[model samples]
Target: MDSQQPKQPKVLWLNVIVFTVTFAVAAIGTPLWAWHHGFDLAQFIMLGVAFTFTGMSITAGYHRLWSHKAYEANSVLKVIFALGGAFAIQNSILHWASDHRIHHRHVDDNDVDPYSANRGFWYSHIGWMLRDYQRNRYADYTNCRDLQKDKIVMWQHKYYLPLVLLTNFGIPLVFGVLHGDIWGALILIGFTRLVLNHHTTFFINSLAHIWGKQPYTNKNSARDNGFLALLTFGEGYHNFHHIFENDYRNGIHWWQFDPTKWLIKAGSWVGLTTKLRITPEERIEKAKATMLLTRLKTRLSVSDENQRRIQLIQFEYDALLARMTDYYAMKKRFFDLKKRRLLKKYERADLLNQLQKMKSELQQQRKTWYSLAASYSY
Candidate 1:
């Protein structure tokens, strides 16, 4: 008897039809209608504002809060995110989180990752949604069980269709009526904004994985692209996010253009968000140092150099690694002592003294490590 698995269906007609119609309306219909009807300043401004809110909703609310649980949001913020996500029309928060969790868990695995770039740019970008090949992938939302408990998430999933219709059509129609240019608002704010949002977000899965540098880790296909971050509200820092998924911020640096991180931070000030998780600076630095050393070692191994030169480089590298390990260990102990000072005021003085000594030692180790690493031309 044959035990081969049956091939899953290839075409998802509803998704294909909806995507095709929306793209056609935005690409062909909107421009022609805009030329004929002439959109007003109010319509354009509405498009910009709506686009920002909907996009951030997905980044800050859906991706960070629901998918990764990077931070906790107040009820009001969660509801707003849910509504904004619905307006974005990506899908319900539950479904989106489930798929995203799966993507992270099985990144680059063609068989498991929902939008694995290994399947090609088109498949990762938009082609995956156009087929039912991964039909059973999200059936069990085991990864997103925490999200399933949220009332807002379950509510949005239950009435996602209605919410989508109301936000996608109702909001535009209401605004269009007020602006006295229903068609203009509908074409510009409705169709055009949706297409822009969809494609920009999709670019994170496609171009983000293909382009840019991988400073954090090369184990995955994720890359960090500042240009793409500008387009996707800072989601283009894919390399860092892939390696450190729980960090609230994608762009770890101050000037990395991550509006989502800013929004969440602002929310915390107003009591709308809490527990914004951050990866320790030492761990991040260690990862970078490790990657650099690994690359240098790989290069040295392949070079057809004399034994004396290879041995010298290897000795220097070993010394650098030792300093790095000591620096991180001392840094961790310093932080642990600092954290303890908050709870035990009686030990504050001694902890401070130890922290100072540890800081000085860590600095010396780091200096030695960098000097040794810089000596190598590669």
Candidate 2:
């Protein structure tokens, strides 16, 4: 008898039609309409507004707030995100978060990961959605039990289809009525915005894995790409995200283009969000230092006169990590004392001085380590 072949999952014609129709309208219909009818400033503005709102909803609301629980959001804020997520047409929070949690847990596992990039770019990007590859697991939202407790998340899940219809059509129709350009609003704000949101978010799954540097880790295919960050509302820092999955901020530098982080931070000021989780600076620095030292060690191993160079590099690495440990330890103590409000004025001043001195010493050690690491890169 011949061995049985595994059955392929059937194609989801609804997903195919939705993806095909929206893309066709956005790419082909939009420009053709614009060439004859022309777009005004308001139409373009509506496009920009819709695009930003929906993208932020996905990055900040869906990925960070619901999926990772990186921070706590108030009921009102959660409601807005729920509505915006529906408008974005990326599925309900329960479904998206369930898939995302699985993706993180089994990232590159082709057989398990929902959008495993290891399967190839097209599959990770959009092909995963075009079929019933998940089978009965489509309704298996066990990973999202916490999100199920949130009234906003549950309401969205229960009424998701109607919510999708309401926001997707209602917003565009409202914009159309107000702007007195119904077709222009639908084409630009509705179809075009949807296409852009879908693909750019998909880039985080596909291109983010294929391109950019893996400064934090190489365990998975995820990489950090600045250009993708700009396109995806600051989600391009995928390497960091994979390792530090619960950190509310992806682009952890002040100069990085993480508007999503900024929006969440801004919300905290008005009490819209709280308990924003972050990876400690010590942990982040240690990761970078470890990766750099590994590369330096590899490069040095190839040199004929590497004994002394290797010894020096090892010495610097040890010293840097030691100083880092002490600095963060003292910094933590300083904060604890400050928070408790039990320190005498002079004692507080003494601790502050100690922290400053340790910080300066750590900075000097870091500079020496980096200088040494850079010299051997060639």
Best by lDDT: 2
**Candidate 2: tens digits of C-alpha lDDT, residues 1-378:** 999998878999999999999999999999899899999998998899999999999999999999998999999988988999999999999999988998999999999999999999999999999999888775658887787778889899999999999989999999899889898888999999999999999999999999999898878999999999999999999999999999999999999999999999999999999999999999999988988888778777656579789889999999999999999999999999889998899999999999999999999999999999889899
Please list the residue runs of candidate 1 whose C-alpha ends up more than 4 Å from where it truly belongs after superposition.
1-8, 301-378
Residue 350, model 1: lDDT of: 69
Summarize candidate 1's per-residue lDDT along 1-378 as a digit string, tens digits: 989998766898998988888899999998798687777677889999999989999999999999999999999999999999999999999999988998999999998899999999999999999888776666768888788788999999999999999999998999988889887788888889998999999999999999999888999999999999999999999999999999999999998999999999999999999999999876787687666666656555445563455565556556655655665676576677777655366566665666577667666766765675566536
The lDDT of model 1 is: 0.86
TM-score of 2: 0.96
Q: Kindly state the number of residue pairs that clash in model 2.
A: 0
Off by over 4 Å in 2: 1-6, 302-304
**Cα lDDT of all candidates, in order?**
0.86, 0.93
Error of 1 at 146 (Å): 1.4
lDDT of 2 at 163: 93
